[model samples]
Target: MTEEDSLRETRMPSLRIMAKNTRDVMKEPILQSILEKSILTKTQLETLLIDLVIEDEFENHISYKEKASLRSKAASRSRGVSRGAFNRTLNQARKNITRCFYTMLLLAYLGLFEFTFFSPFEELATRIEGYRRIRDTLAGKTDLSSEEIESYQSAERTILSALDSLSTSLSLKSRLSRRKTGSEIESER
Candidate 1:
């Protein structure tokens, strides 16, 4: 086998493990709802994740063509697109991420981010981070009592419900309803 083929063969197991873990995370109801409501599509998120894995996980840096192939395999896509398409999706994901940051900056600049209104968003972020840590902790434990398992499950369910509710509340429709209209502001002035 060629050197590149041998390298790919060695990487397959790690790639598959990553893909399975990513799939499991994406299957969470809260994550599914958030993805559905977010600017990035699954393909775009998958593309970005694959790109990061390829870049950060390997000893040797890979080319765009190889990255594209790896992305297709990781996603289990039957009909994989070309490198160009993968690059396009990666760019789109990056653009969406940048736009989100800019939007937050604009909100801060306008002095529109009141603690009363934005605290929930911050809390949601903290909860999501904590949930990830909890999952990681649970996954690392090879042996656990039934009670412990049950406790983890209960916590997961409670967090999922809270996450879903927080996501729903942060939706555009909900935000718009809570905001004052231009006319309302003018009338107040």
Candidate 2:
């Protein structure tokens, strides 16, 4: 053999020795614990991993009759228990339907109120515009005289004051209602 070929063959033995030494060093710490916990040989572990792969690939499982038997057993149990459960389910469904209908009515009422009566800014704008137009109409009048103008002004002031009082009372009522509702929910919880 050539000198280079002999040297290469000589190096392979030491290389194998080094690799085996490294493997033993790495496995030494874990070996005792694994041996204590499991009775499987290396071959048995390999076989089990192979079987799991095969099962996943092939979709192999219990017999169809066994599955049908389990399903029937489950159905029988449900039938036994559902005899008493039907009435409660029916009653709860009826109650839910009633509550849904009532909610619809309440929403309709709220929508109507919103459309007809809840335009605060528009109402205030219209009322103020009416007062302004009346004042403008009475401004250049010489036939009204001083006494009639004074009386009309007094009446306008009274009506405006009453409207302001009504707005304040409505605001307070809304605030108090919200506070009461919060307290009631807190008490219930």
Please give each candidate's TM-score: 0.75, 0.24
Clashing pairs in 1: none
| Location of the lowest summed lDDT over 10 successive residues in candidate 2 | 64-73
Pull out the clashing pairs in model 2: none
Stretches of model 1 off by over 4 angstroms after superposition: 72-79, 167-189
How does each model score on lDDT?
A: 0.73, 0.45
Model 1 lDDT tens row, 82-108: 899999999999999999999989989
lDDT of 2 at 2: 100
Query: For candidate 1, what is the total of clashing residue pairs?
Result: 0
lDDT tens digits, residue span 1-189, model 2:
998567545654543343334334324323333333344433233223222332343344422222122111132332112322333333454565577678758967777435523355356557656655766687668688777678667656654554554454343344567578779999999
